[model samples]
Target: MTSSTSSSSAPEPIWAVLGASGFIGSSLQAVLARAGITVRFVKAPRLSARSTDPAGILAEAAELHDIRQDLAGDLAGADVVINAAGLATPAGADSPELRGANALLPVVVADAADAAGARRFLHLSSAAVQGHRPVLDESTDVEPFSAYSRSKALGEAALGARKAGACPVTCLRATSVQGAARQTTASLVRIASTPLASVAGRGDSPSAVSSVDALCAFVLAAGRYPGEVPAVILQPWEGATVASVLLAAGGRKPLRLPGWLCRAGLKAGYALSGLLGERLHGTLRRVEMMWFGQRQEPGWAEATANVPEPRVEQVLRAARQQR
Candidate 1:
């Protein structure tokens, strides 16, 4: 369950992961390497998280001016191509860069991968596609309420629309991802480092989370997945809430506001942002996600891939220690 090693005798896969330096992409490379898979990176200049690349087991790396360029010849040997490049932050949604990464990027990669004769394509999407829901699953209709979520939904749809004859594609819709390098974890580290911090709302709203370990496991499963393509909303079987995670991260109770008051305040804040021609950079959307997040079951991946119970608390503990 911890490692994504396939039991089948199938030969190791040749993987070409786009955006190899971001939180998910970076972690994915390490996981695949640990599994002894042959993996390479296609580092888009616009996509890398770090200004300088980190040393790793990338067999080869490329800087492409356009993701849609002819890659079939160079990538002919790749078994699968993973579009792990994405905009993870709220501010990224409002920025002009989103159209390329969150909307146009995946489709371009899918088309290029298909042309490159990759057998399969796996895309990394977010559970934010659900916006604010009570219970979530793969079949739940996504109702994105914010720019970030909307972009993710659009990316899914774009990838979903590929020509039927192309490479088989699967989307891994994950919950709030927590890892050492992830933006969310970094934000929590800053909050925990602060001597005084206050959490908003009742601090008990249920929010699904995916540890980097779990998310990476799901991705690896998708590469070797033999069953029909399924909508996999990856999360622990047990549920956790925003307050619990915050407390676990910082080890201090955050200032709480009434649930109703929090919602009202968010609405007011949104209105003021419009009036002042200001942008909160999806802060209100994030608050809404925390206040009204959904609970989901792993379902398909659990039954087929045997994904593990994500150690959510462990992920938080690691972040705190790093702080």
Candidate 2:
């Protein structure tokens, strides 16, 4: 499933992408190449791996404003800087490393983008910042609960606090993104393939998902947009409902979970969360999302109205194939 989004009207911007080897980041690079855009890849050192200079890496990251590694020289030629770096596994164990990657890294990167005279700095944030909130948008108040959500929210807030610059910053709060590279998407599809999986409210709720391709399309258009985009943009929804997506991936509809049963499960899930913390809470958030699904602002899609329409069905097909 590919998108042909070429436009001769607006000049394409040179891209500098951090974390270019990660799933989303790598996928984005493919999309950019397909569209004939010039890009610079700046891969960050892996913090999760055993490293000899872990302290040096941590110090160079923006633990504090004074110590942020100056990256302007690396980003000098780029017109747009896309920050695809950060800890992707939000459910992992908490530590200073996690917080620094998710929370402090953006501050350093944004400062560098400004110094480099880039036109924009696009930060990849997560919808997890909203936690299990029923509805969400760029303007909605944050309700971060888990260690990961809190860290992501903190990054957004830290970036938000900076004074406006010619090189503006935009944080993209991506939703439940899926692709062939993500094991999590494969796992979800595998679960839905089984008879044990069930959905809430007859599975009519929005899936709150956008394919990696669609997300890349959004970034492609938004990055070079001739006008102003919001400081924070929710990943644009592409009209795939939970039931439909599951059916696409599994070849059968997920069993319907009744409202009463759903409510009881959530109650029990929350009660158990006190002891289990992230492990139990992660499951609870998934349940809440399946039932309520979060609402988002439509302005993002409207702003990029001419961008190629997303093929979410193909995304599910790929997930099914991978699973």
Candidate 3:
């Protein structure tokens, strides 16, 4: 943990973040460190894929118990527990890893946070909860289609199922978070930067993409929030549209395509994905997001605007630097 305190009587709030080595978690940790906050990182086990085998279940259970016990001790002086661990690779959705990190691990982390009497537990969830929503909100219910989304939804449900306890819980439904360490963002920028343009749904749909900087702002604001935060908060859109992304990437305007053509393409893609199962599910969702986009109404970010986010161009430039 980085000690950012003086001999002053009032000490700064300490943070204990799981998956601190992860792309998003590490970025947030850096921001927290720069802010002179004490942030301790607890490592979670990367267990093998789960199966129907009873032995696998029992083994996983034992591991979870051990992690919970160990983490409680590590969280001694931590005021907030941020769960940024999870299997994010859409390709690995069908694997058992998703269930462990995304589904089972959150509940266990929450347990440890509660056991340690942490002031807050911020769960890093995904907007993938509702795959193709016109507008995503805190009140949005889980209607996941792919394994990755399902696992995330399951985690949220499990946490909700638990009895209300000491720790105040908040779930951050991150929308298309991108960072320099993310290969996904690199690929996306390459595609978007191509001297081609794509305009769909009247060319007003939000890009549905956000940066690590913005996410960091949200995390800090939520972490240091004075009052009780909402149980669920969607990432506030920063007004980046598909056209804007393309303009930033390639410095050109795109041709407008009919919304019906986009919808038709989506229908066919979904039908093929359904026949194949799971593999293309997340990809199709991303495609839909690119075409139709998703809207996030002003909420928590607006309520707690303590932290400042970098400009969209700065964020995209960082993504461009990604290998």
Candidate 4:
């Protein structure tokens, strides 16, 4: 996506997006560009080193900032601020960097928004906060299972507390977000690409899944909505399973592994990743936890009813182009 100066008459709102290089963040950049919105992206320096490709890393770094030492000062002229930074950790692993980014970043974002005199602060949260419930809504109590979820919950509370009477704050709780393959969803796609991934033993319950376009649209809509509450959840449509998405993406003949076998395979993969001191295969374990551990499904019709329908095919095509 190309970036350009905002028009004087239009006064294109300056959107400061944290984590602008991530799967959601990158897609947001493209979507915002298509919508004619001028945005400035900010990202932590250390995190950029984890990228696999040099070109990708440099491309992301060009529009990012190292938010480690000073965050408020970096977000000076933002009219709207969206924090899409967070960690996707395995169940048992404890990464200090992930913890800080997921738990402490909201406070930083709120402080930066306050300093920048931003009209709205949008914090991207996870649906994992709903725990193992069968269905989740805006009123559902948060019961996080892993460190990532716990940290997100903490950050949400921090943002809420800091948003008392200043700029409005909106905490978006998104469901299983699928789009361009990334460190989080890459393994799942790879496994599905293999001949053995299936839903034989997996639960067939209706789950909530949001496409990348839908997610960006929700963020844009929430930023424009006039409301009194400081927090808002962006749940998507239910009945969207991993199997369904794979089928929709043109998977010819998918395999169906028993649930027990799927779990065991994931356990073995994580063990191997831990032994090798790498992150390549552990992503499978994280996806398994998200699919099985969380039973809650979000309702998104209310938030997205007015928004335009997301071009799922275009999103899938973008993923393929990246590959």
Each model's backbone clash number: 3, 0, 0, 1
Candidate 2 per-residue C-alpha lDDT over 1-323 given as tens digits, one digit per residue, 9 for 90 to 100:
12233556776557899888788988998888787776688755333212113243334443444333447777887888999999876566666677677766776788888888998899999989887677767774798867778778877877786656678899988888888778767876787789856777778777786688888988888887878878988887778787877787677888888878988988887887767766677667766765656666676756658344776768878878866
Candidate that would win on TM-score: 3
lDDT of 4 by residue, 1-323 (tens): 22446455777767788888788888888777666678787764343122222233333333344452356566777778889877755354445465456655565566557766778888888876665455666753777655556666656655554435366777888776767665434544555556644554443535354577788887777766665433757545534555554444435335556777766877787677766654534355345633453444334445445444655444543554455
lDDT of each: 0.65, 0.75, 0.75, 0.60
Q: How far is candidate 3 from the true structure (C-alpha RMSD, Å)?
A: 3.3
Q: For candidate 4, what is the lDDT?
A: 0.60
Error of 3 at 307 (Å): 7.5
User: Which scores greater on lDDT, model 2 or model 4?
Assistant: 2
TM-score, one value per model: 0.79, 0.87, 0.89, 0.71
Model 3 scores a TM of: 0.89
lDDT tens digits, residue span 7-126, model 3: 446676788988888899889888887776878878876654364233444345446777778878877778999999888876444667777778777777787888898999999999
**Which window of ten consecutive residues has the lowest lDDT sum in model 4?**
48-57
Ranking by lDDT: 3, 2, 1, 4
For model 1, residues 218-280, the per-residue Cα lDDT tens digits are 788778767666633444443567767767777776666567777687789888866654366
Best-to-worst TM-score order: 3, 2, 1, 4
Off by over 4 Å in 3: 1-10, 47-63, 304-310, 321-323
